[model samples]
Target: MKNITPLQVAILVALATAMLVAGSAHALALAQSRVIMLSLITGISVLAMVYYAINYFIYRKIKLIYKTIRSTKTLGGGEEVYSMNEDPIGQVYDEVQQWSKEQTSKKEEADQLEKYRKEFLGNVSHELKTPIFNIQGYIHTLLDGAMEDPETNLNFLKKAARSADRMEALVKDLLTISELESGSVKMDWENFDLQELLQDVFDSVDHKARQRGIQIQVKAGCRAPFMVRADRKKIRQVLVNLLSNSIHYGNDHGLTQVGVYDMDRHFLIEISDNGLGIEAEHLPRLFERFYRVDKGRSRSEGGTGLGLAIVKHMLEVHGHTIHVRSSAGVGSTFGFTLDKANG
Candidate 1:
């Protein structure tokens, strides 16, 4: 049998006593009837006292526990709040479980943030240290003896200048990322021909491409004017970064191409290259600052390592996304969308 509550026990005890008195009265003499009646009355009185006493003591303890739980919540105002259930102990246990889950979730989030913070700090230090060390070495060499040699002196100074330039670029890129992430960078949105913009980007990097013997091309289907709504200067930067990456990583005499597709309400722009394509694993973090497929190659190519990161953030601010597809040895294509201008 299931265990009975205190109230149930009290009711059962009183009923049993009354039934015993009724049964005994039928077998007792007339004189014993009065005694049986007295016994029943006394039993009932004792049962009533026990029921009220138990409730009084137990309810006091429950009330105290309820107050403690409510105090922990610190709810404002003096208005009454309903209990979670009739059993205050069970309700308290449930609330404690809920609180534990929330705390665990918060701790996990905190741990992730801490990990990212450490990685970011380490990356920034490494990037800045490279140029700083290079500049120091060049200056020391010139100081030791190269200063006396006309041929080496100018070369060393140029090397130092280049390292300084890299440092400046790194700092500027960091500031740009901070501003973009902080929502402080204002965008000047306009309706402009995306085809013309791509042409301009190619033109700007044409000298670099030619130096490497890499051919830059616009797909025949995308040669026509494709009007889009976006921040002109920011989008221009995006194109420059993508195109530059393609050129830097492209194989000798390889081709870098751009294609624009007319999707309803948007234009899908893709930049492709027959270059040193990235591996599947690297594609996921391609837009992470300072992340590189080949660190030595990327650093030697004279970039701040923040180009793709900047591209991703700029597009994100415009409520669009960029994606990439590539095979290790074949080629890579990066695609992003732009809102099509109604005009």
Candidate 2:
């Protein structure tokens, strides 16, 4: 039975009473000649009152059920009333139960994610601290040796110099990654020639490529002066990092290719190398900070493990994306997009 409010019940009661009085008055107008009609009118009014009272009791019960379902507090202090076996109220209770369960699950997941984030920060701190301490120790050794032995002092000084340079590189890469991540590093967006940029990057790494016997090939579909809107300095850094990585890991007699595709909306630059390619499992996490597939080899090569991470962040800030395609023994390609000049 649907619940009726107190006001509605009162209204129905008054309507019934008015009908009974009117019937009685008609009977009185016909007087003694209509005694049977008067008796019938009184009986009908009694029956109507009985019906209203029964409905009122049922309505009150239904209303009580509704109040119970809507109440947030439990019947005891801690037990929610999820259902009552009857109409409207039972459905509401079921919905509340489902919502409560969902909330509980989400809260648990949030707690777990927070825990993982903390662990990641701890790991990063440890990684950074080791390099810093090594650099500090090397400097102390160099300074202390100057008073004891002249030849040893010079050797220590060179070692200390190398350590300092490594530390500087690490710190620089860290700053670049932080700025890229925080979105504080703004690009100088202007029209520049893609071919010129490629030539410059190639020339910068020419000596290294020559020493390693690596050949670099450049292919451009765009005209000599293909213009793009991007930060020239950051883009140069990205190219240097990618190209150096390729050179560092390339196979003997391998070749590196630099290609540019100028679409109407954007410019695509791809750097590819026939190197010892990355494994399948490590591909997805390649952009993660300080992630290395070959940690020992990377350390030996003086890699800070933040190069690709920096590349990813910088490209993202420029409203671009980078993607990699590789086969374990074949080769790898690193590609990124740059916005085309407006006019």
Candidate 3:
């Protein structure tokens, strides 16, 4: 009865009322019953027709409205609208409320994405502008009388070349990130000695470390060669970027060390520096592009501010993640893990 339609209930009420009227009139008198009976039959017939026509029109309109609402739900990518047993109007109200909430959530997410997009564009522009402006200044000075002065001519040319190189590095890093995000970078996987790779990186950056009196060495237990499977070129880039940061950010005569740990099927690698450590607040955002704890010092060290960002992406491509632990004045450690080569 609870699931019965409004039209069914209306028909039931009309029939019950007609039966009561006929029963009461027949009890009044049996002599005039024939005349009353004829009139009663005619009235009942007319009432039945009127009730049927009215209910037919109302039910048809209600069904059409339900179908329209169902079609709307389908277009909105909602679940299949089921046949309503009780009240379709109430169900429609509930669905509309749910859709409104979902739309509000989507709007918030879109707003956040738009904000990030704008921030990224601004950062890129600032990074490129510095080098471009420096190059223009150097060229203009050289063109003005410095070109005729032998002492300043070669110096200005070198400075201009360096600025151009910085711009080139920035562009290259940007391209690499774009390729990585677009899934266009192909990994060249191979089994290689992790210890040997560290040595190569150390040798590559030895001169730079020496200029600042920094000592870079592997931790004692990690000196042994540990084989891992990964893209050799990308891993090399990761190592270079991490080591370069340590060298650039370390204090004079500071120590930078890398440690290795065996974690069953994986190897954990940590690059640590006892220099100008990062504050705890900055650790979460360390991998964001162009995010610098010390912007002036970072720029002075000739970095494109994309090294750590690239490092994070490269590791992610290999199904890995990088983490950082740091304190303001004590030290900083960056760690990542790679799969061990199968026997």
Q: What is the TM-score of each candidate against the true structure?
A: 0.81, 0.69, 0.82
* Per-residue C-alpha lDDT of model 1 across residues 1-343, encoded as one tens digit per residue: 2534556656677777766776676567546667577668956876787677756776566667656655655334563343422443455567656656766888899999999889999999989998999999999999999999999999999999999999999998899899999998898989999888887888899999999999998988678888899999999989999999998989988999898998999999999999999999999899998888898899889875799999999999999998999998888999999999876
Q: Give, for candidate 1, the lowest lDDT window spanning 10 residues.
A: 79-88
Off by over 4 Å in 3: 1-84
lDDT of 3 by residue, 102-204 (tens): 7788889999999989998999998999889989998899888889999898998898899999999999999999899889889899999999999999999
Count of backbone clashes, every candidate in sequence: 0, 0, 0
Clash pairs (backbone) in predicted model 2: none
Best by TM-score: 3
| lDDT per residue (tens digit) for residues 1-343 in model 2 | 2654444444566556656665777656766536555555655665566556744675456557656654643333443332222343445557567657866888899999898678667756866676678767766776776637878777766776777788778878877877776777777877787778878998999998999899887854543676878888888888999998898878868899988887679878899999989998999999988888889888888886888988898888888889999988898999998888777
List lDDT for all candidates, in order.
0.84, 0.76, 0.84
